[model samples]
Target: MNGPGPWGPAVDAQGAQDVLVHQALMYGSRHEYLLTAVPYLRAGRRAGDAVVVLVEPPVAAALRGQLGRETAAEIEFLDAAQWSRGPMHALASCHDRARADWWPRGRLRLLAEPVWRGRTPLETREWKRHDALLNVVFAGTPTMIMCAYDTAVLPGHVLDAAARTHPELAGPDGPAAAARYTAPAEFCAECDAGPLPPPPAVAARRSFATGGLPGLRSFLFTEAARLGLPEDRTLPFVLAVNEVATGIIRDGGGRGSLRVWAEAGELICDVADPVRVLADRFLGYEPPGAKGHDAAMWAVRRLCHIVETRSGPQGTQVRMRVRIG
Candidate 1:
């Protein structure tokens, strides 16, 4: 079935629409943006219909802050804890039970049939393929189908048969299904470079530090090559690397300025307090936990430089601005 056209009841169901957002199977780090789900809840309440967000514990906490006690009365938050007990149990126990009841029985019957089948990988894949297309049509909005990192090998026939033929469906990554619900067009156009213009002195300081040291230059070149970042993108990467190294110097048991440089748009680093951050590559250093107050701010400043430097249609460097904040 064709997805609902742009102006359809599902998308226009302001104040009276019953919408179910299925966020199951979403990992925390990758899907942290789901934290924005609370804003959707707030939107639903304002619109006058009930909004249900089904998510795991970590997501629940992040969302609760958005809803808070004051705004939460109208919206419902369902925890996905023990959702793995089984699919049927998950569907029945999800916070949206009442809303699901309002859906037509035939629709419910069709939806429930596949709940069992989703347990198997093959079935889940087929279901997602089916749902990706159907959600757009039925709901008159975009739906994101979470695919594995290795989606390059997906058969052309599979995508051809499932996707809608629309120019608006294009995403930063190409043919984005998630763009349906969230307006990808706006996201693509809006460039909010956070903070202000960075001092030239800071830029010069970084340039000098990187130029004098081969290790720092090599680091930038290596990482730039690794991510295929363009020559221009090196500055941002350098900034990002320095920001990280600086965080280490400030937080770790170090007592010197963190030094950085860029070569061919790759970052190299030398910390005055080296012992803390110069751990064995990859396996040695622990993964950075949730970035804290100062760390987050530093990330924002660095990412803003990246975005400002490379802002344009069809920009090579994917905008990393949002995560910085």
Candidate 2:
């Protein structure tokens, strides 16, 4: 059932047992989502209930380590792409079996945005849909899907309050609370009212370097736009990378320098000035986007996961250590 009400799934936990499924796109960096899931996992352990975690491939190793042998053994980890690319019928059968065995597949929930079209400049209404679609597909049994990212922002105390206070479509004391949230009457009905207030801004301050010679050239161009290094100054560096390279010249205000060189297989970079990275610890900074931005922040975060977790094939390593002066 689709609704415009506060977006999220409902689990009835009045008297029976439960399993809370948390599908994470991020490895585990979102603190609020972890904040929400930790309590549920702990509560399940304390009460001898079940809790399962479904994570993407890059994060499985780290998660296995964090949860330890016993607890980790209880939580199941699977690849996120499996749900999207795998055979649907076989997946459904497997999910059903797991549910029968009291294990539910976790869903990666996306905060739903409204569809807009028609005008040259479209008008979009605000609609917030919080349903764990991914979790439901993977999880065969009755499930409670919660987003790790949102839960990170919301402390456990706050969610416990909402769970206790909000009118339960089905009371936690009831049988439906543990079931998937796809049932009728479990979703918001007033989407016409518009979306929830925009979520608080997340900080996303970081540089994107291509690595090696290509990386160096990209950095120099980026720097030139912001710092305006002299053409005479950049000419030699440009030629080193550019074959038919003429000197780089600037007509207006720019104040940055980019240098490129080779070191083994990895690219090393040093930026004199950066595009104002956020200083806050909890949130990364996001820059405003122009039309047809080559990549999305989602892609960047995925790349970040690769850089942070794996050393990669050929054992090449990329580092982004910040050296504060």
Candidate number achieving the greatest lDDT relative to the actual structure: 1
In the range 261-287, model 2's lDDT, one tens digit per residue, is: 222322222222222222211111122
Model 1, span 1-87: residue lDDT tens: 222422122332453333322221222242434333333345445544434444565555666666677776544454544443332
Model 2 worst lDDT run, 10 consecutive residues: 119-128
TM-score of each: 0.29, 0.29
Error of 1 at 191 (Å): 39
Query: How displaced is residue 102 in candidate 1, in Å?
Result: 5.3
TM-score of candidate 2 relative to the true fold: 0.29
Model 2 residue runs over 4 Å out of place are 1-14, 17-29, 86-95, 103-142, 149-325
Q: What would you estimate as the lDDT of candidate 2? A: 0.31
All models: lDDT? 0.34, 0.31
